[model samples]
Structures are given as structure tokens and as C-alpha cells.
Target: MLKGKTALVTGSTSGIGLDMAEALAREGANIMLNGLGDATEIEATRAGLEKRTGVKVSFMGANLMKADACADLVAATQKEFGTLDILINNAGMQFVSPIEEFPVEKWDAIMALNLSAPFHTIRAALPAMKDAGWGRIINTGSAHSLVASPFKSAYVAAKHGLAGLTKTVALEAAEHGITCNTICPGYVSTELVDAQIADTAKARGMTEKEVIQKVILEAQPTREFVTVEQISGLAVFLCSDAAASMTGVILPIDGGWTAH
Candidate 1:
């Protein structure tokens, strides 16, 4: 369905980002994978995706925390793939700590990656997408974007800012045939969450199992982690003709967490 189109999915070396990239690739979209990962492993992934999906795929190691680098990432994608028809702002970072003890540097890093990076990419990619008269911009937001929890001050603030950005861009781009939206997902079973579960277990003197149930998944009423495949499928649907009129929406794939 996406033949001749190009997509750039940040933080796509693994996890949710990778799943979305692969889904777009399966739909025949050329893929540009971005994020930090071991060189050999990332190359293997790039090659494997291309080989399996029979679509063009490339990798870029842009430091999304820097606005200039984020702009360059869009430019590099355009240079490699001709046009960025879909932009997935999936690059993100999270810092868990009380407001009183959250490090200043960590806050800055989270905001840069989670919030500002998307702004920079959208700014850079919009011109080409507008000229082409079509685009899809999907921001990977968190359940925290809709509701807050303690200890994740920076993360919550950044995601909320992203939600605002997605809405504003959607309004501006509506007449230009571009759709912008945020996907607010609940706790997902990504490697990042697994690590957080282990860390919380260690800090709270609880078993890993306990941390998952009582800490990581406590707010998720479903008590089940959202799967990467589910998130990727949502991205695919949002990019389709069926969703062209679905712009400016803050979609929740949070397993009923936001329903409450």
C-alpha cells in the first residue's frame, strides 16, 4: 500500500520503534532506521528487515537529543529515500525519580529527546511532506501523557508537551493533506520496561515479579503489558486512507488505562 513512500522511525534499532518500522516496510515503504545500538547488531537488523520485506532500508545514527542532529536526521532520510512520507517520533528516554531528587541533567535529556526532538524533526520534514501534499506524523506518547504518576516528573511533562505539539501540528497541516497524532500507550513489554522492573525490584527490596505487578503495572488496569505488535498495527492503521480524517487525535492504545 505504501510503495514508493519513505518512512523514518527514530529509536528504531529495537523495541516498539523497530516493530513499527518493520510494519511500514511490510507495507512496501522504504525505511530509515535511527537510534543508538551496537554497529554490527544494527547493520544485521537493517539487512534482515530489507531482505525479509524486500524494501529499501537504511540506518542513521543521529543523536536526537540535539536539535541540529534531529534536523539532519530528516535531511539524511530525504537524501537517502527521496521523500519522508511518514515520520514516527519514537525516540525517547525516561527518568524515574521524585521531583525533589530528579537530577537537572536527566530532566534536560528527557525533554530534549522526548519533546524537542520531535519538534525539530517535524519542522524539517514538513516542508517536503507539504510540497508532496501528503504525510503521516505519529508521536509515540505514554499513558503518562494523559495521566500522571509520581516520580516521573520530567517524563510526564515532556509527554504532555508532545501531546500539545501533535495537536497544533495537526491543525496547521490539516489543509495540506498531512495527519499528525499521538499514540498514548500504557506500560509496554519493551526491554526498557523490563530493565525498569528489575531496577525497581532492587530499589524496593521486592522480587522482580512483585515489582511488575505492584509498581510497573499497577496503574495499568489491564495488568498486561501492551505488545509491540499491537502498537505497530496502530501505526499502520493511522497511516492508511481509512484514517485520513483522523488527524489531531490523541489516540490511547493503553488497554483501558485511560478509560478510567
Candidate 2:
């Protein structure tokens, strides 16, 4: 579906990002994987994706929290691929604490990586996307983008800001055949969530299964976690010609988490 296109997914070494990268590759888009991880692991992932999907796959290891590093990643991707058709800003992390007790450093780090990095990437990639006359920019937001939770002030704030960014970019790029949208997901079975579950289990003296159930209960529709493939499928749809008219939209694959 995306033959000859180039797609860059940040923080793609593992978790949701990795799944999305593979999804894009399966659609025949050349992949540029980004993140900080084991060199061998990164290379192996790149090689594996390329071999499996028969699409070019490359890696860019950049600390996305740094503006300069983000800029460099954009430059390197453009240099290698010559043109970029898709940009998925999927890099983010969480630091949980009460707003009154939130560490300044943690707040700053979350803002840098979760919010500022996407802005830098969009700015850098816009010119190329605009010139191409067609592009897709997918920002990975969270259900928190619409509704906040306690102890996740920085994360919620950054996601809310990202939602705004997505809308604004969509408006600006509307005339140039570029579509910008945010994919807001609820709790997913990522390594990050696994750690959270473990922590909750230990802190509350509950079993892992009970911790998972409690997490689910927080949402209106208490059930399964959102799957990476489910989110990736939406990304694929957004990149398709059929979705040309969709922009400035927050497509929540959050199992009705925000509907309430």
C-alpha cells in the first residue's frame, strides 16, 4: 500500500513504536527506526524488519529529549531516504507523582521528550512533506490527552499539548496535502505498563492479575488493554489515500475511555 514511501517512527526499539514500525514496513514503506537501545538489538531489529517485509529499514539512535538530536535525526533520515512520506512521533515516557510532589527535573524531561521532540520533528519534516504534496504525520497521544489522572501530571500535560500540536499542524498543512492527526490510546500491554502493573502489585500487596483488573476498572469499559496492532491499523488507515480528508482529528483507540 505504501511502496516506495519512507516512514520514520521514533522510540521504535520496543513497545508500541516497534509494532508500528513493523506495521509500516509491512505496508511496503521503508523504515527509519529511532530510539536509544542496545546497538546489536537495534541492528537486529532493523535487519529483521527489512528481511521480513522486503522493505528498506534503517536506524537512528538519538536522545529525543534533546532538540539538537531531534534535528539531527530529521536531517539524517532525509539524507538517507531522500523523501519522507510518514512521520510517527511515538517516543514518550511517564513519570508518576502528585503534582505538588512532582520533581522539577522529571517534569522538564517529560516535557522535552513527550512534547517538544514532536514539535521539533514536525517543524523539520514539514518542508519535505509540503513539497511532496502528500504526507502523514501521526502523533501518539494518550487517553490522558482528553482526561487527566492523578499522579501523572507531566504525562497528562504533555499529551494534552501534543493533541493541540496535532490539530494546529493539521490546520497549517491542510492546503499542502499533508495530514496531521493524533492517535490517543488507553492503557496498553507495553513494557512500560508491565512495570506499572508490577509496581502497583507490590505497593498494594495485590496479585499481578488483580493489578491488571484494577487498571482496567479505571476506564469506563473495563476489559482488555488496547493492542499495538489496533493502534497501528489506524495509523495505516490515516496514511492511505482514502483518509485524505481526515485531519486535525483525535482518533481515540481507547475503548471508550474518553467517551465518559
lDDT of 2 by residue, 89-174 (tens): 99998876667877999999999999999999999999989998989999999998999876788889999999999999999999
Best of the candidates, lDDT: 1
How far off is residue 22 in model 2, in Å? 0.9
Clashing pairs in 2: none
Using Cα atoms with residue i matched to residue i, what is each candidate's TM-score against the true structure? 0.97, 0.95
Off by over 4 Å in 1: 202-205
For each candidate, the alpha-carbon lDDT, in order, equals: 0.92, 0.90
TM-score of 2: 0.95
List per-candidate RMSD values in Å: 1.1, 1.6
